[model samples]
Target: MTITTTLEPVTGPFVWRGDELSRTDDWIFRLGPDQVAELEEVGRRFIADDPDLRTVSAAQYPLTAAAEAIRRFGADMDSGRGFVLIRGLRMEEYDDTLAAAIFYLIGLHLGEPIRQNELGDLIDHIVGVSDKAYEEGGLPSRTRDKLPYHSDSSDAVALMCLRPPASGGLSSLVSGATVFNELLARRPDLAPLLLEPWHYDWRRQDPDAPADTYTSPIVSWTQGCFSMYAGADMIESAHRYPGVPPLTGPQREALALIEEITYSDGVALDMDFQPGDIQWLLNYAALHSRTEFVNGADFAHTRHLLRLWLRRDVGRPLVENFGKHVVVDRSSTRTEDAVRDTQGHFRIREAAAVRTDWGD
Candidate 1:
């Protein structure tokens, strides 16, 4: 299918609750062995060409017919379903360098990778770096605990699992649009709270960043589309500010209703991720979470997933607050700072941007 770019918002793109959708086929894409080989060849060529142009953009990794499929995948993130599970790669077959490069190559096909944290990590590993969980200000990307249902600070996010746990670390996702609709259906009174601007503690997304916090509403409506910028932990952290308003009784009750419905049977979909599984989510439309898992002792059996935060062209028009972790904004001159480890694994140094990023 030929994809055409447009800035106009797609009105109320079909929203569905967990009970309403069940088939993995609705969103999952499995790459056949031949396609996998072709992608690997693309990675090899990308490396052979520049050998230094790592993780810059998807266009760097030239694709043949595969480009169309990947573009279709991205198109779905905006115009069709808001999430997709691409399975069927044998991660263990490849070493870390090749595996990571391949994942980054796929990400480049989607969009330019943005700084994931103040650390400026373009690609991140989703395994605990410390014992602390995100609730205590530890980075969620490096936590082993449960992540609350929240939209990530990006236009889209991709996770390619290098290794999965033995059991109990299923990824859970709920439609943010569904949450928006549910708030109105159950209690219109609380629905307005979602549109209320709320501050979130930057929590060290940047160490040298100027502000301690930034504000945005949970839900935004613009260009005939409803976009969500929500993170329960961030909203709860906002209470530390004296000026920030507390969640009113109606807001609290409203949030409770949404969460209740989310975890309820048939309302949320939990995924059993396999090694080499790539999960892509449109951050604006999907509220995602992760459950706790038992980690193995060694690298082979341990849980590790590479994460990418990409910003595609033609994103929905958003409000001012929407640009907090702004990747592409009106005033921004950003340059990436990156280097590889002794093992040749790519690492993101601290980054600098105009305003796409607010915290360290």
Candidate 2:
């Protein structure tokens, strides 16, 4: 793998500061009334047909009313800002099943949804089922702990807010390019270390995996394009397993500086999620985080978000081993015959109680 150094700062539409972005509403795309009606009609039809999700395609459910808008959203994520917030779904009109169908329909237009877990689930639920931390054996998706800024294992990631928590649970995102440019300017010595191979815990993603850990560089530059894959918690946790080397002093300092840059003022953009709002992000261009939240006792009122990891039809170049952990299969071979329950809804509560797949 040839890792070239670029001391010159990366300048593009993707390199945006949060404080500057917050002052403008340009990143948000609101659905019009005609579009919402078209979505509702198609969503209900999808639930009625009940086709196998594994084989469904964008061609099967055409969204003529919103096709142009969806295409723009895709362009914005890929070439503009690396992220977009789509609002105005009118959540009160539909139940969980219909809501999921709408989210899935839009996702199909954007990209192919990949399996999110060993269960081969295309959609993963983000809800706090337990109060314990992930380090204590609890799943991060099922806990209320604050998640650190990290990239998921896919070309892009989309989240649809079905229910907002009663208290705090703001979703935040930081530009990986912006962070890298700042680091290069402030700590040039540490920037090169991110290109070196680093060990990360694999048991966190799958308990029964053949290997306990996997290796990858935090940053990669190829063909004049830059990509990033980061999760400091996973890098630090790799120390628990045997055969993995300990992090050197400079390596530790590099990790610290990266985190400091992400948390610095104007670096991370915070989004107060609203019901029916969906946020799409390019995984290589952005790292996302969430604040700890409080949920009500009622399961019906609990905070719930649907997550989809997509393999884009259009993608950027990457160096070798930069993102080897996530296997983006065209179709899942390990999923259950039926991912949803008899009531035509995903059994999120039951799945959360027993699921072991955990990552940011």
* Candidate whose lDDT is highest: 2
lDDT tens digits by residue: candidate 2, 217-323:
99887777788889898899888898898999999988898899999998999999988999999988899999989888787567899888888855577788886
Off by over 4 Å in 2: 1-5, 208-210, 334-360
> Residue 230 of model 2: what lDDT?
91
TM-score of each: 0.83, 0.90
Instruction: Write one digit per residue (lDDT tens) for candidate 1, span 59-89.
Output: 5557775777687778778876688888777
Runs in model 1 with CA error above 4 Å?
A: 1-13, 48-55, 204-209, 326-360
The positional error of residue 87 in candidate 2, measured at the CA in angstroms, is: 0.4
Error of 1 at 87 (Å): 1.4
- Model 2 superposed RMSD (Cα): 4.1
The TM-score that candidate 2 achieves is 0.90
